[model samples]
Target chain A: MTVKQLTLPELTEACVRLGVPGVGLWREPVRAYGTEAAAKLVHDAGLAVTTLCRGGFLTAIDPAARADALDDNRAAIDEAVTLGTDTLVLVSGGLPPGSRDLHGARERIADALAVLAPYAGERGVRLAIEPLHPMYASDRCVVSTLDQALDLAERFPVEQVGVVVDTYHLWWDDRAPAAIVRAGDRIHSFQLADWTTPLPAGVLNGRGLIGDGVIDLRAWRERVDAAGYQGPIEVELFNDTLWVRDGVELLTDVAERYVRHAL
Target chain B: MTVKQLTLPELTEACVRLGVPGVGLWREPVRAYGTEAAAKLVHDAGLAVTTLCRGGFLTAIDPAARADALDDNRAAIDEAVTLGTDTLVLVSGGLPPGSRDLHGARERIADALAVLAPYAGERGVRLAIEPLHPMYASDRCVVSTLDQALDLAERFPVEQVGVVVDTYHLWWDDRAPAAIVRAGDRIHSFQLADWTTPLPAGVLNGRGLIGDGVIDLRAWRERVDAAGYQGPIEVELFNDTLWVRDGVELLTDVAERYVRHAL
Candidate 1:
């Protein structure tokens, strides 16, 4: 829900009117609209802010960049608390520019978590480490597997930090089902986005909608359910093709697809 | 090298003149040049055929397709023996069309191996399962990690089956170093290719030349060496940008970069 279709306020209104009880949100839009105002809009409309989009990119090798990311993530956690969302999704940033140190980048994720976890716990927000697809391993997120995310999350209290189980990211891993089972109460957020091919230039916005691609979403849903995750399943399609569609129509179609394919 | 780079005879001449002891050949070019003639060209030049590019795509769900793949792989095994290469690299094909069955696809690789391993072992051609980068999981290859390849390889007798450790395909995995150590004698082939971002449209030709990107190639070499491997380090760059350059010049640059970065 970052750009393309509707504003955050508009999306909130649409979600509430459409009886979508829970809505996940990105930070910048909420910031632009004023976080308190955005929070009030969803809160008054009787919608729960399921999760704040992200709070971690703590893998930057640069001191200034690293400091900036931590500051922004702290603000994101505060915003999450303000919006009444218990979950704050963190996309651990990828290999820092011109750096081949994946291990170092991953260690930085742990270092940042050590600092942010207590702050997040204080705010009653769970840091949900979202493992992006392996394609994003070099640029977007180094956390490329559910097992890796789970390993990182287990280092902290489950209430303070947890792992995100997104079908688009984790479906390719054979160990994902078992990892999901092991996640148990550590599974703070579950997202559904199908894997589509001929990934566009940059490969970032090529995700398919719930039933549009080959992922067995119902199987993933069942796996998560078996792990004791009784939460709103979010349909998070970041496709350039789907971005052009009318928001209401897209939401309606996705809601129906979610029922048929993901449930 | 594939056809985009060199004619077999010309590549053999370049290898001989450049003092490069071995060269990897692809199936299509070998078939085109006549496997016997391609064998003669490299053999006469005293160049060891490090590996035949590929021999498996056995994940096709169609019975006919699967049978054809096995038959073709058998032919590839014969070709590998003719070319005097012990390794026949297997890029395990991706999910069958319109299917999300990665586990099933992977199982097909094992099934195919059960048939091909004995066939290969008899001919002294070890089946090397090469895991392509996970970006290829949807369409190109399902085996996307060293451990996944190792899992399949470990199922077969060590002499008949083994794993390929490619730095480009494997560097991002936090477990890759340990996987390489665990690979031990099972590592049949080791390749060096750097990962460059802003991955082009198809993403196939987006590989960076060894030193030009951020993969710690020397580290991977050390890991493989620690695992008791002292083999030809094939510098397999698939960059469209590098492809258009003069073959001799590209080879020279790659050789120099390989020494500087990968050794």
Candidate 2:
């Protein structure tokens, strides 16, 4: 939700001026800029749209909401295709309100993927299922581990449904390292952010700059490399403190930490 | 950290007055009250010390700190025996500051447990390893799931080391229900607290009253009971908001929620 005011043209120009190679576009801003224009802006600057910010929440218990989620996700896939991004990140929704059926919610995510994976595969767009941190397992996303994501991913073709490895969401999990290795080529997108303490209220915008938190970025990077993942490593930080700073400065800060901690 | 003000006598008296069968005792307050005196207070009041909180931080990398942890844990075991509690809660500490070796930290816990188990076993105390939520995996505890806690507990005799089934920590995990059944007789202590979102600044004081949040405490209680755990189902809530209130009213509230939600 950072950079809410920055225009698409300004962001793309800043990327070019700052020598940043690529950018991840969210559905809201890309749609605001017109997906085709956003695609052209990044492409004209010779930058890659690393991954589109989302399309899941397909675990709704309401019949109407479930159908809407499917339609919305299909639309999100079309937008990803238009933006020239192969990765459409899916944050599967959490348990329905007042329901503690975690098993049922997880099953809904898997079933949603079974339907959407084929839709994405035909368009050459991959559905990258992102396992959010366990803290968000109730309200945000129920897919809370790489192991869980891979378990769901393995159910589909490797080219269609894949897992996303984000340090901020997964660094705390001891199983993450082995899961990264086991993921192999199923890792659709790799993102970097750090985990900091005293997580803010809502706990959404507390992601730290790479070296500022406790994540072993270098170790995770090495493990991913060992897995033969030759993909773009996106430095995606959703930080409250950094969001208030100049976007260009934040980008520079991320790039600097990328070299210092994650190389 | 809740209920920091009430003295041991006052706490035990409150328990007796409120018809509360038992209370969870922390090491700091118990030590402050003089373990023998505190034990006598609870024992005379016919109150069971459900669990003595905690005796860990055994993940130290330095030799001296590690040795100190072991010594402290040994003393903690002796205190639990004095307090008339068979269960000694152990919150395995997180990564050593500035160290990202999660695997190393976990192994250190196992090593510490291997040493502590036999010592505890001799004294008729069970080391109940509590897997905190993953949000606390950095600074508080490396063990973050029932499965992981069981993996560590299985290495020792069931009488020497067992797992604590706390709803606040394990509710979000989809595998938790099965892990409960898998734990079977090794479930030493079962605690209840609900998972609430917008987790406080440090994410420590966010545990909700039994039914105040999203956890299916009744279901968890059922699962633990099904696992053949006929032990004290401790209602442990660590809410900052509740701590400032009158202890009697809070105890009354907890007692009410325990029946409506946990029973």
Candidate 2 per-residue lDDT over residues B1-263, each given as its tens digit: 34555677877787788788988899988888799999988888899989999998989999999999999999999999999899999999988888877778989999999999999999999999999999999899999999999999999999999999998898878788999888999999998888887688878888887787888888888899888889988887788888899877777777887888878
C-alpha lDDT values of all predictions: 0.87, 0.88
Candidate 2 positional error at A6, Å: 4.6
**By TM-score, who's the top model here?**
1
- Cα lDDT for residue B180, candidate 2: 89
Give the per-residue lDDT digits (tens) of candidate 1, residues B170-225. Answer: 88788888888888999999998888888998788888888877788888898899
TM-score of chain B of 1: 0.97
TM-score of 2: 0.95
TM-score of each: 0.96, 0.95
Query: What is the RMSD of candidate 1?
Result: 1.6
What CA RMSD would you report for each candidate? 1.6, 2.0
Worst 10 residues of 2 chain B by lDDT: B1-10
Q: Per-residue alpha-carbon lDDT of model 1 for A10-72, expressed as tens digits?
A: 787777777788988988788889999999988988899999997888998788998899899
Local error of candidate 2 at A237, Å?
Answer: 0.6
Question: How good is the docking of model 2, by CAPRI class?
Answer: medium
